[model samples]
Target chain A: MSNILEVRGLKVMYGKSIAIHDINISVPEGGIVTLIGSNGAGKSTTLNACLGTVPATEGKILFAGEDITHASTAERVRRGLVLAPEGRHLFPYLSVQKNLLLGATQRSDKEGIQRDMEFCFELFPILKDRLKQKAGTMSGGQQQMLAIARGIMANPKLLCLDEPSLGLAPAVIDDIGNKIREINQSKGTSILLVEQNVHLAFGAASYCYTLQVGEMVAEGSVEEIRNNDVVKKAYFGG
Target chain B: MGVIPNIMVNALVLASMYILASLGFAFIFNMLGSVNLAHGAFYMLAAYITYYLCAKAGLNNWVAMLLAAIVLAAIGIVMERFVFRPFQTEFDRVVMVSVALMTMLQQLAVQVSGSQTISIPAYGNGVLDLGFMTLTNEKLITFLVGLILLIITLYIVYRTKLGMQMEAISQDRLGAALQGIQVNKVAMLVCGMGFALAAVAGAMMGAYQQVSSNMGDNINVRILMLVMLAGAGSMNGILITGFLMALLDSVCPIIWDSYTASAIACSAVVVLLLIRPKGFFGHEM
Candidate 1:
């Protein structure tokens, strides 16, 4: 499949410190591409740069064959590059329904939003039950579910998830993996997932990129990555 | 005037006025995460602007009040884009910027209107002798304006889409940006609303009490204290705390000297904060 999103030589900096350096990544039109790395591996920064939250100090980001390197975060989102950020960043004070509704902020299609809300309800039935409850009051697993569901509500062409299974039980992590597959297979949406859980990442993605210390060290299918000794030792614990 | 009736009227009037000013200050502080010392300047500047339009430019007091609100709101948009936006992340710089704004506006007010206290001739100078109490039209008008404005503020914050976005942004800037909320535009809108509220409060209170350049300086402290007591991200808390503080401001002077009354109020606030730590509705912004 043709690439829906591509980052070429992208470098991101935080003051004097560089977070991601000369990173090249892409999400094909219908594939799950996972960036598996440990904490402080510049994984989240790569996602932020693609979403335009962090400015790319160098190189270009092409979305759907259009140059979108210097776009505003909102513009990037509107153009369907949505990120369900790390930390499950829900508006803690707002009700769950409000949080879910806010996910479709850039869209004015009332019927479409309603349909998507129903879609979220179907995906996370707990969200429907806790519509009036504050988002922060929910359990961690449920909040992660809500975050992924909220990201889906944006009608994203490419959904980027940062640390989706960061602090969840094994069963919940399995559930997240299942949902990632469902999103890919059902919606035909390209995904760029950042994860510290190498096992979950390898299971969910067709292709994986191993990032270590602000650099892409490996890129291959799960079987191919298993054969790369350095990547296997560093990420797969081989 | 019956002593109790007079005090009650004073309390209500003062509470209403203080709420108008403090609500604006609190929202700006929460949304922008800035102390916004310049908020008081907007209040003082609005009074002078209205006063100028009425007294010098030959406009009706009511018309001038509307004009002042619009002008101040427009100025607020410019300020948010330039003065406040640059310092969004740096709290120290925001404080410094606001201080500079306050100084310049206060000087302008003093230069234009002098050191003496000024007043807008009451909205309709008449008293309603309701047997138990004497109430002037100015007192009633100020209270009504305050009440109506408070309602509008509540409605905007609770009912509108933009208000929802503001709350989201105030809660988590990164999360809101991820949701494509266009945070800068919302921040600018909030600043406009804040300046407009300050203008209305200043114009009304100028008629009620006095309009001096230095008037804003003292009231600014009162507004800040009210906000701190209310805590961040708690707009309703601001309204409640504002009323409580206004009652203290009005009632304490009757029982003791003004400074002693203020001391008691401050001490009580300190105790309450010690007990709860996060004000009444303390939530993170």
Candidate 2:
């Protein structure tokens, strides 16, 4: 499979402190690729850098072979590199339907947008029922679902999910993981998953990369990483 | 009865102008979470521009008002891009910038007009005699203009895609940006709209009252009170609070001391705050 997104020698700095250092990763088309790491391991920094939320001090980002290193965050989103963000940042005062509509802000194809919106509602039926409800009032799991649904509304070529299972109940996490897999398989959309939960990451992802202190320490197939001694000790607490 | 009608007309005129100014202030506040202390300065500058166009350039009063609104809107866009956008939401810097703007505009006005009050020629010269009272047609026109503008503003805010984007940004800036809404572009539009609205109100008030460098200071206080009383992001609340405050400003002087009207109005706002800090109809805290 051809790589849809490639990050080369990406570096990010927050003020004087370096957040991510010379990290490189590539996501191939139509599969789940996850970055597994501990808290503050710069998984979010890497994702932010790719999304153009945090400027990469020195690096190159190629989306579908088009360089987007200096693009604005909104421009990056318009070009289909969308990030769901770590906190599920939904517009709290807006209705669920409005929030979903906003996800398609860059697209002018009304019919296509409408179809994707219907697909989102179908995937998250609860969101359909609560279409007019304020996003803030939704439960954490429901909001997470809405966040993913909102991202899907963009009709993105590659969907970047930042810890969709964070703070979710185990069953809810399982449901989200299953839905994510369904999204990848059915929609044929590639995904870049960033997660601290190794089990969920390994189960949902075909390939995984382990990050430590702003650097990629290991990258291999899920099965390969699962069998690695260091992966077992660091991720599974074996 | 004649006195009562006169006071009622005055109340409506005051309320309309207050609503116009406060609505603009509230727009910037809602969209950017920026206090926009420079709003009063914008209002003052617009009034002077209207004065210069009509009085000095000999333009028609109505045409001058439109020109002033457009000019001020452009200026507001520039201000947002250069001044406000850079120091957004920084309390001290916003205050400093606003105070500096106010002083600079006031000094310019003083230098040009020599502290003399200027007034636009009245658009409507006659008065309408109702069965109960005599009312100036100018006051009636001002009230209707304000009402129409308010309706238009509401429609633009609630019914349009731009309105949806504004609401989205107000709710979550990062979320809006992630959705591809250009925050800076939206901020410029909002600032332009807000300043234009305030300018129109300033010109109308300048025609009805006398225009001076410091006229905006009084209106600015009233705008602040109206926004606070209505709660941020609540448009309808502004209309209701504006009328209520106008009623207080009108009726209180008849029953109580003239100075007590300001005190009473302020007390009402304070009491409302004590009861509900977010003001009535505001989204939950």
For model 1, how does the per-residue alpha-carbon lDDT over B1-285 read when each residue is reduced to its tens digit?
488778778888888888888877787788878788888888988888888888889899999999999998898899889877888888898888889889998998878777877787677788888877778888888899999999988998899889899899888888998999999999888888888988999998888887889768867977987888888888888888888888888889999898899888788878888987877877742
Off by over 4 Å in 1: A236-238, B1-5, B129-132
Docking quality (DockQ) of candidate 2: 0.70
User: Evaluated with DockQ, which candidate comes out highest?
Assistant: 2
Task: Quantify all predictions' global Cα lDDT against the true fold.
Answer: 0.87, 0.87
Clashes of each: 0, 0
Cα miss at B45, model 1 (Å)? 1.7
Docking class of 1: medium
> Which 10 consecutive positions of candidate 1 chain B have the poorest summed lDDT?
B276-285
lDDT of 2 by residue, A1-238 (tens): 7888999999999999988898989999887899998888899999988988778999899999999999898888887888898899998878899899889878899999988888887788999899999999999999999999989888888899999999999999999999889989888989999999877888899999988888888889999998888777776667
TM-score of each: 0.95, 0.96
